[model samples]
Target: MPAVTVDNILTLPRIETPALTAVDRPVRTVTTAPTGYEGEGFPVHRAFAGIDMGALDPFIHMDQMGEINYAPGEPKGTPWHPHRGFETVTYMIDGIMEHQDSNGGGGTIGGGDTQWMTAGGGILHIETPPEHLVMSGGLFHGVQLWVNLPRSDKMAAPRYQDITGNKVALLSSQDGGALVRVIAGEVAAHQGPGSTYTPIALSHTTIAPGASLTLPWNPEYNALVYVLAGQGTVGVERRPIRSGQTVVFGKGDTLTVAAADTQDSRSQSLEVFVMGGKPLREPVAMAGPFVMNTRAEVIEAFEDFQAGRLGSIPAAHESL
Candidate 1:
């Protein structure tokens, strides 16, 4: 279990914003920004669904899901970018990604790999592929989530965590399907990695074909679910979800999901992300590449980067 006492990150926020103030509490669906698929900075899906961590801390947007297909010798990756006052949790389910950051963090993350970065003050990072890594059509799938840092720790130092498969604890249901984790909290018997950020539970779960599972939530936090593969029937309000879809629940007591019939019995499973903390009811003014409570803070973030006030990245990157 997470020894999440209030003292962990006191500067973040207190339970106030009803949206993420508590877990399992009933949550109403609210419309937020940065939704839709981006083939190249353009929207395809009318409304790209994102998870809003209800009544919880730091969790801002759940890029619910993304699938990138790469052709032979074709390059596809994220370049250097900066983020202040938040965190990014990238979970890889298929293919591989080479991660390099300005904080001197470098590694290659493969399927079932997770890279967690805390962009406290600020940081720049890039992700590329290795040579001969993918010749044919390689599948790149996963979720890139944005978690808002609490007000108090907005200026704290930055941090990073990379968790690979096998190292992660796994707890499965009797049928050997439907695995649960503590990744950030206590779920069943499995416990996830420890972190400087407490009171935050990140759950990574999967259900076998024709299996049903109900993820536990603390009305004391906010939660959301994204379907990785196969068909899933989510019953937050008797809702149904297909592959590549995300179901977000706000202020709800419980988040429920079941796998629908899959082709070839597909051995299917869904990766669900459950996150919540005290809601920061303060005003959120977000623009491209930045998120802050006010426009002035946003200006400062952008200006600092342009003036070289925030400099640490290598002058040149060694491509893979």
Candidate 2:
């Protein structure tokens, strides 16, 4: 949960409270994420499961990758894979991950770091734990979100951005009871470091017990709040929610969430991942690894990948 924190949260910039006339978004649906395994057998929570694709437009998928503590020699990661028509945003809250892609974009990201890879057109990449982390074993927690590219930019050139924790814009709730770490897009006039093809806002927020936060949101963008840990309530109606749950919000100018007065010992506060994006409103056709506008295009992507048009594993990483 230590994605980013300050010694005194009161010192951070405060998010202005919404005007009394502002519309508070109502909760549309609250779904619980099912536990699963991803990559090389690492645990994950399918954060987007059961949500409608239309509701998640511009956001294809997401996975909450473990709040688990691994033992020595138990770390796992994804094998080399090809992706197209989308961007993969991997944000590490704890532990370390090394990434290498065919387009000559690669890096090591640790706690509070992010690796944003745009697999536009096509690209091959692999994510794995560093050798030392594998040998020593430790806590690993992170989130990977797939952002869809508009049809016009689906075939654009690939790109990468490495965003360190220090680059994230940090802000406090009006009452200083919450810490908001903006990873991408703008929040109350402050922008995050990661660039995005789709207009979106992503933040990790920690709310102290019994505290409430009201966030200004784009009226045109769809809003969602995913609870990563602890218990809380969302919307003005005060719907109860807890870890592994995601709250989809209806149209509005503001979003509200309040932590429970008491939490389990395992989690001292309520941690949530908030996101919203302008709807793409385009037809979506997706295969195992490729997201496209048509099924035929998805088949073509697989063909190209198998034909070596996507990319090859770097010589140095061939052994991995």
Which parts of model 1 have CA positions greater than 4 angstroms off? 1-57, 64-66, 134-137, 194-198, 250-253, 263-267, 318-320
lDDT of each: 0.59, 0.94
Most TM-score-accurate candidate:
2
Residues 1-320 of candidate 2: C-alpha lDDT, one tens digit per residue: 77879999999999997898999999999999999999889999999999999899889999999988999999999999999999999999889999989999999999889999999999999999999999999999999999999999999999999999999999999889999999999877789999999999999999999999999999989999989899989999999999999899999999999999999998999999999999999999998889999999999999999999998999987996
Q: For model 1, how does the per-residue alpha-carbon lDDT over 281-319 read when each residue is reduced to its tens digit?
A: 666666666677789998998998887655456866744
Error of 2 at 240 (Å): 0.6
Model 2 TM-score on a 0 to 1 scale: 0.99
lDDT for 110 in candidate 2 is 90
Candidate 2 overall lDDT versus native: 0.94
